[model samples]
Target: MNTPADRATRVQDIVTVFLLSITAVLTAWCGFESSKWGGEMSIAFSQASSARVQAAAAAGEARDARQFDLQIYTQWVVATADEREQLAAYVEDRFPERLKVAFDAWVDGGMAEDSPLVVDAYVAPGDAEAADLTARADGKFQEALENNQRGDNYSLLTVMFALVLFLGAMSQRDITRWVSRTLLGLGVVVALVGIGLLTTFPIKI
Candidate 1:
């Protein structure tokens, strides 16, 4: 009843079950990780897209501001004393009242080349806000790129899980111990790689 062949067969069965159980666990873990990464990627993409749209709107506003700057320069170049005063009034009306001090200084200096109004130092607050949005959009795009890469890494891990499941299943069917062992070993190697990737790939949940 306790024959060596029966005992050996039982041992093989136990080993097969162990391998299958381990492979199933690994597959489940990989599937969950892939899902988590995918979700993060979507969120990142949405943020990036929203930032891009806001940045575009800000850039458009900046273009309008730049056009106004050009108009002011043109008026200053051609205006008589009365027209120059009118141009100054127009600039005051175009921007917030807070900028009057800077505007007055710029005009008192004869609108010289070194005028602070020509640069961001005295430029409208809206223009500065637009510039900030452009920089923010670039930063969002970079984050989206990094998240996409992390999603790809998790996707690759899912593929590796497939292989592990396949090879481990094959080990259950192979008649020779060496063949079964080899297949199981290959699965282990793939699982190891997936595990290593898990350590490096970014994830939140």
Candidate 2:
């Protein structure tokens, strides 16, 4: 103490208690934030998994549709001239609603059996919709991954807050003045940083 006393004064003891309490509060806050982030990450992961499954199913359906169209085209190729005209008319009539715009354009431009209207990416009406689903599913997965990373950040801060608590406990000793000061300073700095992170992170709670 500056009062020529070897023992700590009342003000020093109060300061020590205040610092210890701050560390404890910050530790709890960080722990809560970490838990909230983890829960949110879990929810995000669940949504992503669901979307992925849906995308896979839609892709399979699109493949099946493509196969059906290809089969019809194959049958048309082996038919007689009269049968060929009838089959072609049937094929044109059965063309997908989603593909009508392109099919009409192809007709206007002189319809060909090998045109891109059927051979391109969207073989069926749902194929284009399925591709859109795949893109949306991928976006959900990316969002989930970002949430997982932010959860990990909160977990790291939880550890840092725990360390602050440990350092605070260590500071309450009859060590050398510099050693005590070092421990206290470390605890305060870590607590401040932990609180900052908990507030700024995407974890709402």
**lDDT (CA) per prediction:** 0.69, 0.68
lDDT of 1: 0.69
Worst 10 residues of 2 by lDDT: 116-125
**Highest TM-score among the candidates is held by which one?**
2
Per-residue accuracy of model 1 over 48-116 as CA lDDT, tens digit each: 778768767876776776576666655654554556778656655665343455666676777675543
The TM-scores of all predictions, comma-separated, are: 0.75, 0.78
lDDT of 2 by residue, 154-203 (tens): 77886887787678677778787678768878888888877787778774
Best by lDDT: 1
Clashing pairs in 1: none
Off by over 4 Å in 1: 1-12, 81-117
